[model samples]
Target: MNDKREVFYAKIMLFGEYSVICDSMGLTIPYAHFKGELSFINEDKYTDLEFAYESNRQLKKYSLYLQKLIDDGELIFEFDLSSFKKDIDKGLYFESSIPQGFGIGSSGALCAALYNEYGQNKIPNSRHISKKEILNLKKIFAQLESYFHGVSSGIDPLNCYLKHPIIIQGKADLSTVGIPRNKHDEKGAIFLINTGHAGMTEPLVKLFFEQCKQHSFYKSIRDEMIPFNNNCIKSLIKGETKEFFKNLRGLSKFLLKNMEPMIPETFKEIWNIGLDTSTYYLKLCGSGGGGFLLGFTEDLEKAKFELKKHNVELIPVYKNAKVIDTIKNI
Candidate 1:
């Protein structure tokens, strides 16, 4: 059954969280630091027997779900489910480092691996994939990922599958984008602050949709959050640092005030501190009930100093020596 497949990496939604649902511009990039691949374990050679057993069990469950989708004619794509089941019987499972319940695309990476290995008439990865093809692929991924998120936008899997930076312009418009090159001596950085807890995206998103039922809440999102979010994406892509920071500050403030529930209670004070001092800005990475909180700071060292007592790890998305060296060449 050949269960081995190329690894699919996790993704970070750099901008546009809830706003993307309403057709605002969103930017996402593949985070190769964490990834997953489908593999079969030989019980004699595997050390973690319980983990292997559990993973195989989960994959069997997922296969059943896929079979149901196939039977109902709900899934538009074709895959060799018979072979997939054969592999599952052989202890096939996803081996991944991507943490679940984080804003990062854990399930999305799994869906991508499945589709990459099994999908019929698969969309080839290329710079030339058409808008229509991309949208169609997104729909397929959305349905596939629904097993995890309850509701799926499919953008996560799309980004993971393509392994490229994606800019979502609207509900159906997405394109590959090249991020602006970092300066060799850049002081600013993007980072993730671990909340030390996982978040369930379905509940958080459900709460958001329920809140949107209110006129004022819906209007505020339309009038303030969407505009700020869209502007931030635009400014960032254009490498307009001043404009980007200005819009980021506004977006950060809006989220702090309006999306309070999404932010972790323990981290709320730090989130506010960032806004109050202009030292840093914190925003929702994803559904944000308790996963990783994304941060932006003009000075990474200053942010670290301010956040040191919090006991949370700060993982820099940029500003690493290797990244700086790559930027220098670029």
Candidate 2:
């Protein structure tokens, strides 16, 4: 029972939200600030036995779900169910800081940790991993994570498992990519604006799929959003700051108009403020029912000043030089 795995971090989809469904390029990065791990509670030092008990109960339920999948031969990979059951009986639970339903890959981290610790014939994270292997891993994760999202692209868990930036060129093409380096003294930043509520990815994604059935909606996405999203990915990857911001603004505007249902009602005014003043631009962080809204600005201080009236937390994607250095090393 000593086979503990490293913590799995949450991931951010920097570009391509629903557009990815239509074969648009998407970029995702591992956000190490929020993470999760599998561990057992020490009942001796713990006062809250109820919390531990509940967590263990939840794990038992999840174990049953996995067992059902295995029994039905619906899962492609094998899991050490005996060991997993033993751990669950010993009160093993996923200890996580990543907020569930916050659009930050909480379920993805759990899936990654589970596969890493319990899956047999696991795929190792390395540069040498073939594209075929990566796609297989993604498929495995997509099936496992469907328990949470109803449907999944599997990119989130794949990114968490690899702990590397991933570029999804289309439905069938994905690869690890190095993010362009950030300047130390740069004032520009990408940030998350808390919406103060958790969002259900299933419903939002379902809504998106339904909307896509409409010819006009599908055309707008294919003609407008996909291009903007792809351009943003290309510009960001190339470190073309001016072009990146330009495409980002266009994407921001397009989302505000077409993706209105995804935006929280409370943040609508502030979202418009960014477009009206050009101080900052906002986009959906993930499925975006009510979780975090992603923001980009050339001047962090100025964006903060403009957003002061909104009672929301502003979390800079990269807060300091140390973070940049750490990412570079990764």
Candidate 3:
């Protein structure tokens, strides 16, 4: 406990943006390229004092809320407020690289790091944590993170907490499954398309919920959107690579057509072009005001050519790993 410990980076849903809410499957992987660390600091050198002070101020407010919950018997464990207060006074803060609203779970990582470092209930071995407990923990973390974003799925924090690949079957059914083998030879791939603007997920998600008030939108989502999402998940899980991308194309189109207003105006034309060109299909990765737009392509080379005009930054993630059997069992 004396040594400083760092939590590894968390890779979020390679797919399943909003579809997962209604029970569509979600796939997540852990990426080590970005991460956060927790440490005990000696109050001597103060370089980024201003930033630290602001972060501490925010953390203090959250901690007080948590303390209140514990006092009301809502939370099960007692929190060590004295030590937490001292750390805050010394300018303690979460140091992170995970981007917010890019859908990689930056806030989730922070919550996980804090829970790991400060939560009184000891982390029993991961093996000892039951499925129910896992879900419950995710729920708790999600609630904690709602302070940042109005509503949270908790999947981000859950992935950060577990630091492993997790698959969601539906709202109530979630489990960890093995990933299929990644075919390095396949020219087909999935990628992140930089939208050149940072998106605010809370606002976008709120808009979606507001739109859901309309019966037509709600019905379309339940009928068209959810089915497309489920099929995409199935195709991907079953190693049906061709079918997976095909379904993604359908999903991208559906979103563009039905969820047009949700997409930022800047990305509208490009999104439509991708669909019409049939070279690549673009969909919202998270809430999508800006940030990264998810894309699927049958031929990466052609997709590159078609997208060259946009000058978008294409980041490859699951180049080789496309299906379910590729990952090792838990």
Candidate 4:
């Protein structure tokens, strides 16, 4: 491209996907392997002009949505709509490698890139977002990301903007935090498996809402699921490997028994095998119907062997130990 700037990285909500809405603990971290940035089309750097044109068109639609937010007084910060239009007309597009609907914050990266480029006044993307500034950014990002997923948690976008590991204690509590360091040869790991298709967040979210209408289902999540979710986050942060896996198994089993629809149909058998053998445990990466399924194990080699029979492979995210302030190879 002629020009590219303002990079935004992908995010993984490691724990507390849907339960975070219920005021439960959630943890997220930036995944530098996938990212997006603002770029111009008329350049010798790219071989795919059509992709850039399509991205430009999508950005045009998003700009229109943002304009409406401004016109209706819903926008809280200074966004330069006029400048944004000029760039779009000149063939501005998002150059990205992040996969959409993968629960890896593709749209969140786009939002971060856009806001970084067009926002006149913005929250500093500081590593130590140890103050109330996190909440302000969350609120703004929630509104910006709503255009993609009808109801946004804003956590994904905030994760992209901050580019740090964030711990969410509840609705009113969130701050960037440190994670334990891992060795290259460590056995315990966090990993992912591709489910072979994209999952629609809107539909899955609607399904979750519908399920919540049933008191029994909601109570199950509150009493059963949230505890598992919260404890996993707690143990992982504290570097309590034994405790983390204990809670992770609980979380995976709970998903298998109750939130089955979130797990893709084809992988259900394999998911069961993980729980039965205790070689590994699979959980919803995000709103999981089909996309990436998050997996955890105390032993990566054993998990790989178990997954091989299913014709699947695990991609390790974190290994050994250590919370990254800025991410490197996982």
Best by TM-score: 4
Task: Give per-residue CA lDDT, model 3, range 1-330, as digits (tens).
Answer: 335575757565766787776566777766655687654344454435665566677787877877777677876444566677777776677666666667667788888877777667745326345677767776777776777897787788777777767778766666665556663336767777777667888877888888878999888888888778878877776778777777888888899888775577888888888888888888877677777777777778888888888875577655554422323532
Winner on lDDT (3 vs 4): 4
Task: Rank by lDDT, highest first.
Answer: 4, 2, 1, 3
**CA displacement after TM-score superposition, residue 273 of candidate 2 (Å):** 0.7
- lDDT of candidate 4 over 1-330, digit per residue (tens): 224476888999999898987788999989888888888887656537888899999999998999899889989889989989999998888889989999999999998887788877788898865559999888888989999999897899999999888899988799988776653237767799999999989998899999999999999999999999999998887778788889999999999999888889999999999999999999988899988999988888999999998899888886664434235222
Count of backbone collisions in candidate 4: 7
lDDT of 1 at 241: 76
lDDT of 4 at 32: 83
- The residue-by-residue lDDT of candidate 1 on 222-307, one tens digit each, is 99999999888888777677888899999999998999889989999999888888988999987999879999888889888888
Report, for every candidate in turn, its global Cα lDDT versus the true structure: 0.84, 0.85, 0.71, 0.86
TM-score per model over all chains: 0.94, 0.94, 0.87, 0.95
What are the runs in model 1 whose C-alpha is more than 4 Å off?
1-4, 43-47, 183-185, 320-330
lDDT of 2 by residue, 236-288 (tens): 77878788888999999999999999999888899999989888899998899
RMSD of each: 2.4, 2.0, 3.1, 2.2
